[model samples]
Target: MVNLINQLSMPLVEVALVLQKHITALMTTLQEHLDAAQQSANANVVKPWPLDVEAAESSTNFPVEKVMKVVDSQRMDILETLIRVTLIEIDASIIEGLLALRSWEHLVRTQLALAKGPGQLFSPLDIPEDW
Candidate 1:
């Protein structure tokens, strides 16, 4: 039988292996962010936004199914969908924070894919721009 690892270039294979280690940690972080959001919602949703948003913020119900899907897959795309859908469900006029957490995660994966693909610089895997 052909080895699956052999199908990938060694650097990319290693990157995948490295990323596998973070699924659990990222899940924990995902939960923490959700918890924080819940806390903010519980405390004062209007404060998280701005202006007279009490009317707009009165209703918010994150879909359990979508959230559970992200929890199961531990994928950023799924989480992004959950965030976007949930915000839309609540009719959020403006979001206070951006979700570049997933984008940063994606950039790391991209860098890994380009590890040996071409002229790639050794960019530090640090937080990109902002969280």
Candidate 2:
């Protein structure tokens, strides 16, 4: 029974040692990855938009001016088209609301006409004076 327990415990000890080694290696790898990520983050810090523009301008090899002009032109065209579409949608909504109002007015006028003859305007409701 003692030998059998020793055999089982020896394998368990070996497995524990192997697991510890793997854990240590994993920790070291994770630390190395963390350091690399930190270094990369420091190296690749993002500049502000104005600084980015300045950098682009300073890099004279690229045609930044022409690209900007084209982009601006396209942007203006898109804005104009969007504005026209929005105006058309707004006009359609206004027309729809006006049509609905006109329909409601017609219904109200018809009801009022049916309620009274041509020159009489008021409706009398008979109510009891008691609370």
Candidate 3:
């Protein structure tokens, strides 16, 4: 592996580096989105009280109706944003993984060709399942 990396041309090495950076960034962004989703979900606490208006009015323990209404509104907005962001992040991560896989595959093919003649390269062989 060291020899392969050392033998790679500048352009190929740059390609590998770019792919690594993209994968790292995509993973970090995905983690941030997951954290944002958790924070949004935890931002609101739901408390239920007896439905009787007299009891609800008499108790100051329960949240005020106005406050509950505002909280609900914010919760809806957060939920919408979370869903959109999560979907976008998931798509980006999948694409990044695929890109990295493709890049490595190409690099392996190039390295193999350099190590052995093209005619001797990539022969199909069956391996025993048990090593």
TM-score of each: 0.23, 0.21, 0.26
Better of 1 and 3 by TM-score: 3
lDDT of 2 by residue, 43-67 (tens): 1111111121111112224344543
Q: Pick the candidate with the highest TM-score.
A: 3
What 10-residue stretch in candidate 2 is worst by lDDT? Answer: 43-52
Between candidates 2 and 3, the one scoring higher on TM-score is 3
Candidate 3, superposed: residue stretches over 4 Å from native: 1-10, 38-131
lDDT comparing candidate 3 with the true structure:
0.37
**Cα lDDT of model 1 by residue, 1-131, tens digit:** 01221232222323333334433344455557777888433322221112221222223345545433433233333334444565467664331222322333354455544444221322333333343
Q: For residues 43-95, could you state the per-residue lDDT of candidate 3 as single tens digits?
A: 11111111222211121233345333433334334433443355466774444
lDDT of 2 at 80: 37
- Alpha-carbon error at 91 in model 1, in Å? 35
